[model samples]
Target chain A: MSNFINQILQSEKTLAFPIMTHPGIEALGKTVREAVSDGEIHYQAIKYISEHFDTIACTSIMDLTVEAEAFGAIINLPEHEVPSVTGRLVNDLKSVGSLEVPTLDKGRIPQYLLANKLAAENIRSKPVFSGCIGPFSLAGRLYDMSEILMDIYIEPDVVNQLLEKCTEFLVNYCRALKATGTTGVIIAEPAAGLLSDDDCMMYSTVFVKQIVDAVQDDNFTVILHNCGNTGHCTNAMIASGARALHFGNAINMEDVLKQCPENVVVIGNLNPVGVFKQGTESSVRKATQKLMTETAGYKNFVISSGCDLPPFVPEENIRVFLETVKSNNV
Target chain B: MSSELLTKLSECVEFGKINLASPYPPQMKGLPGADEITKEALESGVTPGEILNDALISAMNKVGQKFSENKIFVPQMLLSAKAMGASMIHLKPFFANGSVQRKGVFILGTVFGDLHDIGKNLFGMMVEGAGWEVIDLGIDVKIEKFVEAVKQNPTAVVGISALLTTTMVNMKPVIEAIKAISPDTKVIVGGAPLSSDFAAQIGADGYGKNPQEGIVWLDKLTA
Candidate 1:
């Protein structure tokens, strides 16, 4: 096991850390309205988390929006918050045709690469996983969803063409991030679960396979995380070549583990809001214990939230998560 | 249409037989599906109300109830909704002509800062199946958009879904915005990172832990 995973196992409590540091902006940490003001503030946030937690993860908030924004999608940034694209991509497939592969130096993508490196280097050996958005999610952000959905019938060719572009950008971005020396990558695929089995196989799986295949190296783990109830796509997700699949707790854990490939690690399923965000520390500990027991003797697994830990989640709850894992060793 | 025909229609819906063109659920492959059955009922002088009540609505209700009890999930509910939608098109004229009345009105969206929408989409279809007219504002809906929706449709119940904790906080403003526009408009919230207490704390009128719960609450309000 990696030292980071060992610390989690050795800790007397449930171990918890964030995936990204808030450099003010959701991505890049540049001045996009509510950006992190400057790099110093972002550094302080990292320092604070590292000083307190057993581990620290990089903070790259808007990694998902970078490629879409570069692709002529008008992204609006609310002051001190993450940026969001203005409209769905279906309104103008022609515009996507004009889109270029985003260079690392051009937009916030490079800064995220920097942030991950800094977090990894600063935290030294503490595990720092770079959370990247899925191709489908970035495509959803770039275009109008209603149009893309309709294109599934009226103009599947157009949808395929656009997805091709998205896949290119996503693969390139993942490759660039992988080159940066971050411990691993977490591909967030919230939109993949929205599609039917056929649509998911066609639209999501191929791109995911490309990214995972492109980023895999002996040094880093490429984790794929999808939030919400993904009971239907569990098997397909494992087949997408992700080393680990992080999904929400709403799904039956046993069912998911059963579908997982032996080499594929399973992470996550804590109810982020309901249990971690709302419950007391003891309850969080108990929940973590239950998850650990369920996965007893499973070598390739990690305890984590079914999704992102809500920012306002209680610190004590995090401690309990680490404690539960420690107190109950497999 | 004969009672036997209606029964077949209900079965198609229960089994999620969308249209003649679909070949899913292999047992029903090459068989007449929801589309053919609904169109046949219309041609046979079946009242839209009977086809809707005895066939489409009942099947969807069963799906919704089953989902509430965890017997089925999003994919099944989605298929059932597709079947219901196929039948609904045949009854559109009835709705337009006021021969058939929708149960109520619902306004739903994913809150700002959250772009995820599977939950919202599921809720929209499930609630629509439960007999309400749904106005989906879509994802990343701002507080102003919600306020405008509430102002434009004063009687519509509001629903907000957020998958991110950062975005779930936005639900509060949407609920407050709707309340500010029309306090009488009921507001319900759900998402991965939300709880009933969070919903209540945000001043929402109700909280649905799942899509089916949202339907049950909407049904109660309309009833």
Candidate 2:
């Protein structure tokens, strides 16, 4: 249970899990439209990625809209791009009473679950982790983000009820993910990063703590991700009781490492959008080398992208990101 | 009392004291907030232009500076922007009647194939709070939309935002289209995937690291 996560965290070799799949899909000569729509192709993309990198774990696409869509939010899926929630599902609190926790079979949940199960069967080299939207972020999608923020001030009980519903769905979703034999789950909460520390603690972390307790253990752990959190909420995120904390490119990584508990694994945070997908091979190597040197002192720090890699990261840059991590041996 | 009220309005915008009714920040409950102070200033014989220039514009400039210095985060910025928005409801009529002149027009949007607009909205609000008319073309905006917009507002500065590296590259063509249509219009770029270097690489006249920096650059470009 603890084998892969422990080995990667404690070992002298730094690992690379760029939260990527577009590159792998492209490697298969398939478009993202095909991969995202088909579970088998998505798994094959993960398998292709496993053969190419020193990864702590292979992750499914961090599609933040899947759970929202399942919750009855309308989602817009472009032919070859990341899907986004189009409109609010629970627009009013009174309407929130009519909301029901969606069955796992609803929406694209089955496809993602099958993709995880297949990735677990095929990727023998490292642990496989499933990704899901975090509770507050899900609620943000269900009720538009800007409205939710104001609603918190104007309508506290309503926001609380919506978060309660989001957590219930996420808990069941993560358990189903655990049944897939993946090592753990990475719960992404980028939208929560938009909240203040206090607001995040109240609205995001408390719910995240519920999901973490429900899903994490020696065998399976929960990695809490918040790419939108620049700085103010790191304390609340650590307090949320997730076994691992994944940050994005916005904050200074070394500062995050300093505040984090040494026992917990701290994974991060290359700018996947800026450096990896956009940079050349030499540029990736230079950025990786610089970050490696900067955070070398931290024991639990695992080298990773700031957020999910875009659907078109260059192959050479991905290779250099992996190789640079391997050569550092920090 | 007039200067004091205007200064308080600026402070309210800075600390996100939205209204007398807003319970945030704890210490300022029942105290007049930006909404109250702006209304009070307007009724105290201060011209609508003075309120816009002396308080709202000055306050947003401070807010942008604080944002750049990491003195505040997005939530606070959002609150202040909301507060400014509440105050603007009072001053909007003056602008319509031509008593309050806008500094310039900024046409902004998220590039085509991108749906994310948090950054774009933030910049739009900040630029608007700085006394500019923000012509926001919503998400997934194409190059033709930009060129047509450029055709309408020939002298306007254009702002492009893209959260994904894939979509950020789309800015190059949009910039080209706008330039080809109106050679003098300057395009500024910013987002999660973008840096000053990328902005320059894409041939944008300017790169705003954040919403504040973007507003500051727009000020310089218009100047």
Report the number of the highest-DockQ candidate.
2
DockQ of 2: 0.47
Worst 10 residues of 1 chain B by lDDT: B69-78
Name the TM-score of candidate 1. 0.77
Model 2, span A62-181: residue lDDT tens: 788889888888888776778888866887867897899899998888999999999988888888889999988888888888778766775688999999998999999999999999
Query: Quick one: best lDDT, which candidate?
Result: 2
For residue A88, give model 2's deviation from the true position in Å.
Answer: 2.1
Q: What alpha-carbon RMSD in Å does predicted model 1 have with respect to the real structure? A: 5.1
- Individual DockQ of the candidates? 0.25, 0.47
- Judge the docking of candidate 1 as incorrect, acceptable, medium or high: acceptable
On residues B103-166, what C-alpha lDDT tens digit does candidate 1 reach at each position?
8788999998777776788788778777778899998888888888887888888889987666
Name the regions of candidate 1 deviating beyond 4 angstroms.
A1-48, A56-62, A91-99, A120-122, A145-156, A195-201, A258-262, A323-330, B1-44, B62-97, B107-122, B135-160, B163-187, B200-206, B220-223
